[model samples]
Target: MTQQLLLDILPGALPTLETFVAGVNHAAVDAVRTLTPGHALYLWGGQGSGRSHLLRARAQDPDGHYLDARTPAHWLQSLATDEDRVLTLVAVDDVGELSDAAQAALFALFNRWRAAASTPDAFALLTAGDRAPLTMPLREDLRTRLGWDLVYRIEQLSDDDRAQALHDRALQRGLKLPDDVLHWILTHYDRDMGRLTTLIDTLDQYSLAQHRPVTLPLLKALLTRQHPDPASHHADAGRTSP
Candidate 1:
């Protein structure tokens, strides 16, 4: 089965606990996967570190609700007022980017949730940020609230991890992406997993469309068409500059 074929069987790529490549974030992954109501989980990591992925996975459950920290405060407050709502999980992404009003609202909601911590079906809060909770620029009280639960730092994946991930993903698609090809990709493009995965998917599609196996030459052709050399752009600009 080709990668495109595998993708065609599904609606689109959906991040789930089963699909996550937990390099050093195993603790965070496990907590999000098994967290019960009334508990809270805070995850912090750099871009492409799988913070959003895990948060989304937790939110995939029937009783889970996902929100961005940047979501308007008035809207988040509305969720807090629903005393009869069955909110087993609430995952908030990018907690560090929350606006002032949103921070205030989250602070209030956190206090309310804490008060009901003893309830059997209490709502749980999960959040992610680029930095640890204490280091975030949020309100002091909210920062404290963010750390009131289990906290884990999602570690960034090393180059070796990314290579292994690419290999693993390719194997799953019944494709044997060569070591040289994978190495070429890593050396030439952004090492961020999210972008790399997208590139892999595009390569798969392009290879299928062209009836060609994935190879270094094919990758070079594809990338060249997509991104002209920056040096060329600079030369053109220099020629036209006043």
Candidate 2:
């Protein structure tokens, strides 16, 4: 799908590193600047740490080329030609998930691109769950070289940061959520920012479906129905039993 369509389906606002309210704010902008000069960067962080978000923002640049490692080897091999030179900003998400042969191929591509006489007008950004690529069950050389460039540890968001993020997201979606409802969702629902944003979208849809305003009662009912507690339902059923 085109990037615009993807954005429409997932309309969560893009988080800016410059004024990012959460996570390791320091490392994000630094990573961007380092990559702008055509250096390979390894960003390490767990899920919900904003690593993928930052990578997506960087890939939005016209010269960027986002190559999902899950893609077929033939696709990547096709990108090796000089015609793809304009694909300067390369993002490889889930590098650890690549196959052994694909890993080797990626390493070779890096070596070839790095050794070019000119900079080749390209930069690479790699993301993985492991801090060092060596821990990802790859060859010794590829693992070692993955850490040759800058590596940043993306920190998780603090509680306050997360609360603000929810509010900001609601505002971006043109939903005027009350502070109490935002807090209730943050306190009761999952802590992952990505999931929280999705819940907000779901609630938005639910509100539209029911033709009702977004209120705490409505949110609670929706959440309870979507994520029903079996024990509580059984208890209520027993109480009403003849």
Candidate 3:
């Protein structure tokens, strides 16, 4: 299957994981490395925090099996067999959304997977929006079992990290962004990397459509169009002037 198809089928793009900067937090990286075979590792963080990105990167292994725990049955079905040699890695995103029955199924799967001495070289990684599985409306058993594994709360990017992330994304898209435009985006929009990446994409489209470079004027125009407040635009325009 094409990379695009794989991405569409998978919860998130795994290739992007290599590009994810874990920053100075060796704890997250160390936890990921210690993921033992037949055990589940829980990675939790707020939205736009790149949890799925890390999980997808781990899924790139040829023997990886990615199941969307949002659909509980698929998660169970993927883990049902004892054929560990077939699948070396399993990643589930939005695992907190699994229903009670699904949680029970997961608990059983984890126990079975953990009990098998010859359980191949397979590892399971789960991502959630909360710090602990207990915070989610999960079964007590699943919550208790999930707590047994290492859990890391991924941190949001710092201001410098966010700026660097924007620069990297713009470079990847083959766009030369001016410092002013970058500053304008960082100042006005949400500081989240995901949103900034999207803003860059939209700016790219706007620039292409107008046959204009991504200058302050074009960016201001786009932002104004999206949120039309003439007074605010005029004030911003004045502030940006030399």
Candidate 4:
């Protein structure tokens, strides 16, 4: 059976848990799936590893709040001590890039959460960084604390995984994306799963407009529109930026 593409998600790529391609991160996904109150999970990985996606998905909970390096310091501090706040689930991303004040706020928040683990306001905190906890450059206390609970490094998708994802997406859309066409796209264009999947979306649209089946020639034509001009036209049809 063909794997399903995530392109058909409601509201379009909203980063829900269901839309996440587990790949080799099944254990991490399951950990987040069953994350309990007062517990914490820290995820570290290089770019394109879907750390941000998971954090955004977890923050969809009614009581959950998502924080990142871009989040304001005051808000971070506020959440740390807001007595009115009840329940659990705080998802923090890009922890390594947090501002000085934000780092302090998060430090306090961690202490409070851990101290209240047995209390009514006990909560769960999920964090992500570009590297493993101890190696992350941050305030010493916070850096050490990140390793106190669960930690997992997210792995990037393999080529087979990417192919399967795109193949699945085509099936879900009820479109015909030939295996050769898939291989061509993988070889010629950007390999990032997001962009590759986006091309699939574009191909579907072009196919609909032209009233034709998906084929190598049609794929080349679509990329031609993307990469106009004689100079780039011949050197690798899909060399245009994704």
Candidate 5:
């Protein structure tokens, strides 16, 4: 199936530029929004630093495409070369995890994209990784291609940013999350935005099921139920990275 179709069927949060808390990554976010065709932007940062969120937001564009480690680079070429294709946005996440075969395919595709850089049909490429392009464990040539245009290190969100994000999320769900409740989660649970958001979604469902408003009590009950042992709770939170 096409990447667009796969994205349509996948059930998950739909990240957008509006939802992303720029924190210290405003430049990175702006670059995504004003991306020029044929240019590639490489973003690197710790887990939950909004790399994937930015990619997904750009992918939401009608002319945008999102790919990950699971997608073979050959498939990328086919999509890029589709007869009726126009200027497209290609967002590749977790470049460091691509397999050897995929790496070779990406290398070839990169050259093609670069060769067409000055053309009207040039494709915009964006990629994210755990580390900078040069530091990634990939072929030297591929690494160069990954960083050919621009590179940015995504800054991890500050504590205040996390709190605000949590607040915004609660409001989106029509829940008035108390300041105390927000404080409790940020203080006790993992701070990773991805995991924290998932937790909030779970709480939303649990609140609906139990016919109770979102409160500290409801959150506590769900967390305790989800992780019976206190030790296991902390362990699980620590294990949840971006």
Candidate 6:
């Protein structure tokens, strides 16, 4: 099998709430599901904890707008004053990364949303970050504003939970992933759900190409071929200037 068939980039389709392995995050999931106009939710968690996934899902709702820290101030200001806008969701992801001007715009937009909260059953704002509102090192006023709203910490999936999620994903694609194989991958490979899920599709393609079952050896072979010796770079770097 040609190892040239690596696919660690394209992680397939966007994640949905259904695809999310809730684990101990039922409260967080429930918050997003029950989110309505006049309400704001702040979710915080480490990377790979499915924070961005949920935000992206909600942002796909009707009239939903997804923003990140890199979003420009002008765009946010526009949203704030878009008179005809009937927003169902305003999902601001990675709040910690927002620029100063963007933060100010967000503050204004938040106040606008709050000012109209008396009849706020038509729009919702969602923000996410790496730390809880009380701990995030952001503008004090912005942090305080976010703190006033509903906050939830998204829990990272445990190893067993991750395996089950991967198995279910593989099953959705009509591929049977053995428990042992899943466990081994968890231990020996990148645990990012996105990459693991993409690996499923990649393995499916490679299996058909090589006409082999999705066994431990096949996985090992694929992974080995895809990821060569990591220490090679260090060895090459050691040959630096004298």
- For every candidate in turn, the CA RMSD to the true structure comes to 9.1, 10.8, 10.7, 8.0, 7.3, 8.2
In the range 150-177, model 6's lDDT, one tens digit per residue, is 9999988998888888888888878878
- The alpha-carbon deviation from the true structure for residue 152 of candidate 1, after best TM-score superposition, in angstroms, is 0.6
- The local lDDT score (0 to 100) that residue 206 gets in candidate 6 is 71
Off by over 4 Å in 3: 1-14, 33-36, 72-75, 81-85, 171-174, 187-195, 198-210, 216-242
Return the TM-score for each candidate structure: 0.82, 0.72, 0.69, 0.79, 0.79, 0.81
Please tell me which predicted candidate would have the highest lDDT against the true structure.
4
Candidate 3 weakest lDDT stretch, 10 residues: 233-242
Q: How many residue pairs clash in each candidate?
A: 0, 0, 1, 3, 0, 2
**Could you tell me which 10 consecutive residues in candidate 1 have the lowest summed lDDT?**
233-242
lDDT of each: 0.72, 0.60, 0.60, 0.76, 0.73, 0.75
Best by TM-score: 1
- Residue 130, model 4: lDDT of 94
lDDT (C-alpha) at residue 8 in model 4: 30
Rank the candidate models, highest TM-score first: 1, 6, 5, 4, 2, 3
> What global local distance difference test value does model 1 have?
0.72
Residue ranges of candidate 6 with Cα displaced over 4 Å: 1-11, 120-122, 178-180, 216-242
* Candidate 3, 84-113: lDDT as tens digits: 446555666666777666666667667665
Error of 5 at 2 (Å): 35
- Stretches off by above 4 angstroms in model 2 are 1-21, 81-85, 172-180, 187-190, 205-209, 220-242
Error of 2 at 70 (Å): 2.4
